[model samples]
Target: MAVDAAPRRTGTGTNQEGVRRHNLATMLRQVHLGGPTSRAELTAAMGLNRSTIGGLVTELTSLGLVTVGSAPAGPGGARGAGRPSPRVALAEAGPYVVAVDLGVDQVVVARVGLGGVVHERVRGPVDPDAEAWQVGAGIAALVRRVVRGAPAGAPLAGIGMSVPGLVRRSDGLVRLAPNLGWVDVSPGSIILAALGVDVPVSLANDADLGALAEHGRGVGVGIDDLIFVSGNVGVGAGVVAGGQRLEGSGGYAGEVGHMVFDPEGRDCHCGSRGCFETEVGAHAIAEAIGCPVDAVGSLGDVLDGYATPPPALHRIGHQLGEGLSGIVNAFNPQVVVLGGYFRALHRLVPGDIAAGVHARTLPAPLESLVLSQPGLGADSILLGAAEMALEPLLADPVAGLQASLAEASSRLAG
Candidate 1:
């Protein structure tokens, strides 16, 4: 007889001490995702005995990762059936990660804590025409300012940066960022040198991080296969398949902007003709709407009229959908989330965009596909970066925390 099996979860293997660490991370993640939960619920969810859950909760409480509080009274104004199980939640002032979203025209830095909370943030503009090193210096300065304001004694988990271009996953290097006019820049080292810190750094594409943020904490949560498309000064995508981010060979899988859509279209900075970016990029939209390339703010103001978008905006939406249809046909994703300018445009001219996509793509994939806007809005990339920084800690909380503390101690002594 032919039999079917259930899907297996990944990254659950552990060493002798790995069990303890993994259990701690699991508990923390549960509370982080579902909000405050009762101890009994956690025990049931984890499939662990009550004693083990108690011990893990004690350790977490001692480390300031979570706090245990009395459960609320039942509907009848009396405590629940048995002894009321204490609720657990992430500590409000615990450790945090520094998240940087380096866009073409601005830099945003945020302090994000466990459970995907943004405590504080700062933003400043940058010159896209400036030298790569100059931009790096500006970003480093902004990062320093944000770090300085972080809670005292909070363990610095790591730094996660989201760049508006292609990044090599092996090393946090910017291979090319056409929108920012940067090439072959090592932003991680530049920022680390500027800060004189020994913290770990993770760098990735802005759209990639946005996809991750949406999948883990936003609208796409629990959706394994989806594509996040971001339109700003550039167009790009982050693809997730089988519950994992798909970074192709050399980590350039999601450069959807470079896909040629028109053979006789405008020239792209990537040295290509008629690329999708040349059709729907912010600069392209601005040009179509009779605005300067730097007049994105004014362009946004004009496009904010969703009830009656201009002809130029409608054309942009059509072009965007045309480009996205190919993606839908090829990847057949469960959903396609729009971010950055695309989100706004989608809100304004969803019908035109849908018409374009429906006209181009095959019926099956398009029928099951969901087109939506980002839930986190402007915060998606930053929150995703924070998630990158917090990943290691979540995988092995005890070891990660110990290493961070030791590094902090060493820095102080030196």
Candidate 2:
């Protein structure tokens, strides 16, 4: 995924060291996103002169974060083209981050490199009702297994986790997760204790991570203002406004599923009656299809038959669009992305959702809104988690790398 543009200098008298670090990060980000760009391309994208680009490239190459090499051949043979431009790209052996995506029924762990590539991954099912510590221990084991499989010379930057709950940004505590039956749990601490490591751990809402993944690497790459709706056992949303995540006062801005929709509808796990989640959540969809709540695989099998969509799937799609209309009216986002089960439902009944949104939303926002499915599929949360873990390193590569290396050394020594 491409990094956001470098922050403009606000005033003169900026610290020279800080400026150099920022410039270095900008160049690395350009390579991370575009892949093996030539010096001229970096100059244009970063708005820096040739000398500055060359110096930054040299520094990054020495630090082992990037490599300067010859660009690939074009459509024509070497005889038909000018001399190839020298290109800069992220090194294959660059540092990586461990990404964890904790869902209600499964946990996914991945080792991801700088350019948003997953080098290795491991995933398995977990009991949703397991004790918090047990869940943490399971995840920690998975993380260790993935870490052990990393390429030999690549340093581990950090760990990032996507939890299906309300996370306290201050301390990486999971405040609430109705589907997982967790409350006031500190999964990060548990995992750290289990692994006995001294690395940074970041925690965020799963839907929020999904939004970040879509914005950075998936379908919403260049679109700044958009909403990512994650529909799993429960529903949630991640909002991006003006190219920034709208995390709100206490990181609770995107809990759109809890909004009261039908006062007379079914009750939700969050203690609300007829909330939006109760209408379109996985359990609700399962009930509509007369299947058990844990019958997700079976549900997919049934949905596979709905290529022409029977009435049931169509109604679900319509309800989803109806719920999304309120969000579109409020946020006026440029796009609305459906993830997880919602993406599956859309595949079954795309036209119904479009019609429902058209019927309910106002013309102004509706005119510009594009409905989309996640490009990263089930891996969006994991990829986004890696991005969060890698941000500090991207901001100040040298310090971040040194700190990570020191931590790794301490772990080995102990």
Candidate 3:
């Protein structure tokens, strides 16, 4: 009989110092995700000894990334033989990022700190006819407003932008944002030019960010497999399988709106006849609600105003479910989050949408499926953008902080 081998975890750290750094990152990530964690709990969660957890916590505290909390002892509360393990949390006044959710209808900018905390935020209307650079300038203004709230001595790690269209993952390049009327634009450099600041910048699809946020800290926190359906001006999706985002080749994976939804329904701006957006996008919803397309900012907000869902919304809800059914069959995610306008639709026509999904999805995938609204609500993409900006600091706290401080010093000198 052949002997079977147990599966091993990949990416075993090779260098001694590298392994230490990785452990530090792991500890920080645990505390960042779970908020304040006791030393004993960190040890248990990280599979590390208490002494190592204590050292990591101490270093993290010295680096200003984490703050130590009380060690009050109690039963079944990560207690130990000696004094209770101290609780560690992300420092409230440590580092932050400028996060921007640049939607076609509206834009939200915020200064976000670790542990998904929003220090301050500002919102602005996006003019559909405005140029991409103008939009960047507008976002820069919002960034300035939010930056005013940053604590003294806190480092601004970088900026992250959430766009409504395809963005190249290799570089924070906006390849095409049809809703924003942008193509091959560099919003990062534009904003930096407007602010005269030097910092790392990240841009990703809004739906992708929404999925990232929802998975990391929102409705799908405990669920590893989930899909986030975005119902902004268009229909798109962000897929997370096994707790990792599925950014396809060229990073244009989640363009469900362009998926041929209907063959004979209506002509889409993408030159396709009856694309998903044609049937279930903002225009379709606006048409159903008897509101002008321009009058709509957030589809969810618009739907929320109605006391009772209109009968026309039922058809849209069914269509939404049919679209999601395809996703459910393909991905078999544990949860499906309804974000953007779909949130309100899910709230109002839960039965209609649920019926369509259940009726169409494969039975097996349906067995472990759930339809949920984003727990973070409109802030999903905003926080997701922050997550992207904060990636560097989370990866290596010491080096990341040093670089951010140097950049901030350079900005001040200039």
Candidate 4:
């Protein structure tokens, strides 16, 4: 996990004090996620004792991370039950996150609060062929606009950029992005330099972010193992196994678009023959119907045309199903989410794909399985990007606490 630089240090605190604050922040975050809970509930959720929860709540209250609310009377809300304990909720004005989705055609910028509220977002066209520098400039402009619009003193913790294609996480360098025609572009550094701030920036593939977003708040909630397939100009999948995002060895775990669907059908920009993108991807469907991919007028028209099962559509759907079946058997995920441009095509392909997976998979994993379009469509990726940016804050309470302390220290030194 990554986080923005530590905030200025507050009055020379000892290491023990820092550790105490970190524990308190962690406890508060747990309470906020579980929702208005009592000290007992917090202890249960954090695996800590009642005394620890009490001390943590006191610290969080002083720092304005947690607030006391009306407590529940336990079990039946009976008046004769034991005294109700104070319930806790996150404070409204905690630090914020900036989520940016850098798409092939547009950029989506969102200012999100700790509570998952999208306080602001801007979506519009961006130069598809813009140089990496230009793209960073556009993002910086959007980020500054968001910062300006935030409540007068809102603290921006960090920025998360959801990109399309392979990203090298080590330095936030984009190793390759065929769609964007970018190579070795350091988007994080560019954005930080442009914004004149050194906030920690995280970059991940769009589909990966989409999976996080969907799992965090959308259709995949409560599902620990799943796959999210995003179909647009290209097709990609994000895998979550055992409740963790799978970035793979090189962080390119989900390049479904490059899967070989046709070895002799057509040429792909990826220099592969009959890749998955040639058959079921948005561009492939559009080309199959002899229309502009963007002009195909939505997935409905494409799938509707598939009812006749033309040579191209039938073969494409069948092959796409073939690829998906392999995934079902290998992972036996609880569910599979199909989103992006393919969402509109769900009505037409779900039955076929389900049948394919059922036919190919063992009986047990197939018995209670589910495969469908993500309940969230285009917005899924955007929301996912926002979630990615907020991930560090959620996963690492110590880093955020350290940042606040560093900020306090800087102010005093000045």
Candidate 5:
């Protein structure tokens, strides 16, 4: 779990008791990110006065959302003149969310607590050709397996899913996941139906979530302009500009993979010729490396162990850079993260990609550009999903907790 890079600025809570829910949620978010912060630190970071911060912490304590430690909790653990502010940390037995990263070759389900803690997780292979319902059912099973180990009273929050496709932002409908052979599938609904649970579920494109996680807590922390390029079965990106997502009108903004790389090169699954994905996606990399196409989905680990660079790999690296140039020119991001198999690719050909982007990008965009790998490794999308799932609770803790408790009671009664 990673600490939030930038804390929210809405903590100067109002004096009105009606808005206590907002103040409590704000306080919880602070502890979840800052980790075991003191009353003094919370005041400074959240812009709330000491008494207001104290009152909110007390309420969260009653709800089992956080616990006060006995140790000195001064900033950096230094003691002050007066008695030290109580050390506030996320409760060890607090609520948890289910986070699923559905991939072409693998699926990861995790029980994630506040402060980004992964209490338990399950990961395994999935057939790309499997029906969406079958895959969703299997993922529900994985979710159940992962959450079995949570502390007894830890309530189940919402579920958030990440898929490598164009997900309709408004409805969690997966419009097209060509690599998975899915079209207009509602993965969230299927998983909830499979689990027979009443909790809410949300889904989003994997690349977009990857960028969200990175910008919020990973290597792209504090970077307002970033591009997270995912090299799963396809080549796609998540863009953040001015600290917000750059989703297009149709929620298909970052389809750089389908952008024309070479009009005459290769045919793409999306009925296009010479799309960028056709030249440098997982299959292309596998073919270039002389491996079976079926094994392409899980090639990151295999490709990473190459101590001696293969000629095919070097060529693919050049192709990767050539393809990225167009994206770099258009986004003008401060950071471009190479995720999934691209991480391994970057390790093999950092220079070629850098040179290619530099050669193609306009002078202004290239000046502050940085090419980096995902700090969370394979967990970027997974954690991003967790972040999304926990949004409800973080926004309004009272309502979120009440909903979970009511659902739990109903399950037991039934």
Candidate 6:
């Protein structure tokens, strides 16, 4: 059990009392990122009074989330010309976040702390063709391995898992995943029951989680409207609009893989032919190049051979772009991010895709559309899952932050 990254300090019990604590915690996190600061700096940044900041800092120091050290004189001088000031910094104590990215062939787990540092990680293999229950067992086993490696008795605040399929997130049940041969499996509950601890678990499509992870800290940081195009066993896209992942009525909003590309093209497992996935997904690339699906490295590697781009790669990129053209024209997003297993167009496809988008879409909609890859690589899904678990906490923070801090305090007190 890893300690909660933002643990709830036990001292604050109720909402009214915890409001000040919540404000202080947020301010301290800001200070940790921005560096040591004075009461004046905290006041301006957090819109809190000097007394409030002082009391909050005291509580934080006692809970080991902040530390006090000597501070230089103010912009002017100390009190009059002889007083010394003290500075507070975020304490590097407590638990951390546990995130797992479960793929058809592998599962990766990571521990992330405050300041967004991935402190530790573990990776293991899974059968791409395994049954849903077996896959759940593998994921559960991998998570336990990661948790046990943490410092003894560390308490975890939450756990998030990314699966390669459509997910009913409210209950952590995976509805469908053709590549993994799974259907109607409740992986979140299985993992939780196996771990024997009650904590929030978030389950989502791997590509969507990957997009969120990258957008949260990587390439799409400042952008509000973006689309993540993931090309793997099957092609999929995760749309982000108004700064949030778009979950359709049933949480299957971005199943771009099923969109028909060519009515007469190769048939897909989803009972569709000439689908975007039929021409651009990993299976298609493997079929085009004459290799087993499992042997293909990644999209980046598949397109590395030709001195000049190969026709097959370009054709695939072009068709993939064509598929995206509709999405761009319809959504008119600020950027489109490419991930998954597309080897040929990690960078080149965006321009080609944008060209198709421009030709099909109104000029105004295509004016500043940018296409790019996630700054974070394959590990994005793991980090994204951790982030999803923390979102509810980040939203309100007061009650949740107190709960996390209190859990950490109880563990420490014991």
lDDT of candidate 5 at residue 336, scale 0 to 100: 92
| Full-model lDDT for every candidate | 0.82, 0.83, 0.84, 0.71, 0.83, 0.68
lDDT of 3 by residue, 79-184 (tens): 6577555678889888888899987878889889888898888899998999878988888888878877677778888889999888999887889888777889
- Per-model RMSD to reference: 4.1, 2.8, 4.5, 6.2, 4.0, 6.3
Cα lDDT tens digits for candidate 2, 109-224:
98899999999999877786689999999998888777776666678888999988899877878889888889999998998899888888899998999999899889888999
Candidate 1: pairs in clash: none
Q: Model 3: how large is the Cα RMSD against the reference?
A: 4.5
Show where candidate 2 strays beyond 4 Å: 1-13, 74-80, 297-306, 406-414
Better of 2 and 5 by TM-score: 2
Error of 4 at 63 (Å): 2.7
Clash totals for all candidate models: 0, 0, 1, 15, 0, 16
Tell me the tens digit of each residue's lDDT in model 4 across 308-390.
Answer: 44456555566667777767777778888887666656565556666656666788877767886786667777777766666
The all-Cα superposition gives candidate 2 an RMSD in Å to the true structure of: 2.8
Residue 120 in candidate 6, Cα distance off native in Å: 1.2
The TM-score values for the models, in the order shown, are 0.91, 0.93, 0.92, 0.82, 0.91, 0.81
Model 3 poorest ten-residue lDDT run: 1-10
Candidate 5's displacement at residue 338, Å, is: 0.8
lDDT of 3 at 147: 77
Location of the lowest summed lDDT over 10 successive residues in candidate 2: 405-414
Residue 392 C-alpha lDDT in model 3: 89
List candidate 6 stretches off by more than 4 Å: 1-15, 21-42, 60-90, 296-308, 348-351, 395-414
Comparing 1 with 2 on lDDT, the higher-scoring candidate is 2
| Model 5: lDDT of residue 5 | 26
